[model samples]
Target chain A: MICEEMQERISELMDAELDDNESIPVHRHLSECQTCRSFFTSCQKMREAVQSIPYEDKRADYYETKKEWWRNYVRVPLPAAAVFILLFITGLIGTSMYLLQSDDPYVSGEHRIIYISEYPEIEIHLLTDRE
Target chain B: MDPSIIQKLRNGNEEARTEFYKQYRQQIYVYCYQLLGNRSDAEDTAQETFIKIFNGINSLQTAAAFRSWVYKIARNESFQLIRKKRPVALSHKLEYLEKDSVENLIESEDNARIVRNAIDTLKPEFREVILLREYHHLSYKEIADVMKTTTSAVKTKIFRARKSLLKKLSPYFGGI
Candidate 1:
């Protein structure tokens, strides 16, 4: 009869779950027991076959579907935020321009006078005949 | 936009509902296919799964867990299908080795086919543990979560399932 310890450790050995210290006993048991060795080989094969099932880049489609679903169901409208931002920027610019043009009495009123423009005097000649 | 649409849907927004279908239909279809192992049953289950997800989202306690929740629904639907089908019993009579066909050789095509068939014939409980462990690469804890069992239980189940599968495959591979 196969030892329970050996049977339990056989699959673990194939899976490499047994530590190096633990593997010695499994290796010795497999060397001595033909049945257990065969079991180990088949276990390895089964693991390989299952692993070969092709994770298949399933992520591509999964990501696409997630994106599509989010776009349709969970997405929020950002147009309002964009509009608010635009209005805030416009108001800031308008206020800045108004401040720049407004006369600041504290910094102004120094008289380094340049010549002001003089309008031409219209000397109208009366009708000579009436003189 | 969809909250408006969702509000409309609550008030009978056919358009918003249509949008929901357009969005999730493919994912549901693929997930169903993965679970059911065939296209036709998957298509039906996918439709049903979506309907449940839609009608029941309000009752959900956590939105972040929705994928697992939806998977749970699909898994249940697939199990129901399996129950209804109640597949035929396997034929295990060893009729092949009787023939003088030199068919028992190690590494023969017949051996591989037999091993494959054996794997296919494994009880669903064992099969699922193997699949979740090897194919899905789930850790013991994660599998326990999916299977609704404790981590130690999952580990024991996986160990046992692998042992059983190896036993079934050993004869074909020429037991040393």
Candidate 2:
């Protein structure tokens, strides 16, 4: 494998996670390349340093816990309010459109009744039936 | 439970919030400590990471992708801390120059502190890989999972990170 290819797999090799075939080339490279050997050594040192140091936080859990209260009480409410505002605006727009289009006399001109004249015979028959 | 806690949290369950914190708090803290190189900054950054998690976790969509989500937050917080010029507090930064500290820690001829301080000086990319490997003990696949990259990419970075660390620490190691 090329140096670049070998270098890329070296980390995995260090972790002993590389596949056997993949590890072979990197192993060969490290044996021959002084720079790669130093690189490998540094990786080991860095791992030790990280491992030895305690990862504990000195801060109390309660201090971190308090933010949850604020998240629940305040932060969550803000998004809800924003959604409410958007919905209210949409409702108003929809209502205005409905009112403007409706046949209601208040919003639109009055509906006029159309008078149609039937033939004289038909008109007489309708009067007779009504009588 | 399973990763479905993410769904419950999204639905506004309070218990899920506590569980979420309990689940990943230390891991994130460790990730932060590894990146920030100090306890105080790591603590602050870890808290900040959770806040982002709390606010944005609902939109994350994939419950299985939670690991990467947290790492992204940790990585961002780390770079932000570093950019803020907060000196990385190294427990071992000075031991190399002083003879006594070295003698005490190097009972068997180990350059442990030398490596630690050198790591602290690495650029964020290099430092991040080392931290993921060393501090988190993440396998290549898991590191790849968090990084949103291939396993090979993670490997290359770890190697490059190591190389950079060696170069940076060479003076302290008295020429590696």
Model 2, CA-based lDDT: 0.68
RMSD of each: 20.6, 11.1
Q: What tens-digit string does per-residue lDDT give for candidate 1 at A31-83?
A: 99877776677767778766654323233344444433323443233455579
The candidate that wins on TM-score is: 2
Q: What's the lDDT for all of these models? A: 0.59, 0.68
What is the i-RMS of every prediction? 7.5, 4.5
lDDT of 1 at A25: 83
DockQ of each: 0.10, 0.20
After superposition, which runs of candidate 2 have C-alpha atoms over 4 Å from their true positions? A1-10, A14-49, A60-74, A77-131, B37-40, B81-115, B139-150, B163-176
Q: Which of the numbered candidates is closest to the native, going by highest DockQ?
A: 2
Model 1 DockQ class: incorrect
**Which lDDT tens digits does candidate 2 get at residues A8-83?**
5776777888779878888888999986677667557656666776556667475664756426332463467789
What proportion of the true contacts does each candidate reproduce? 0.24, 0.39
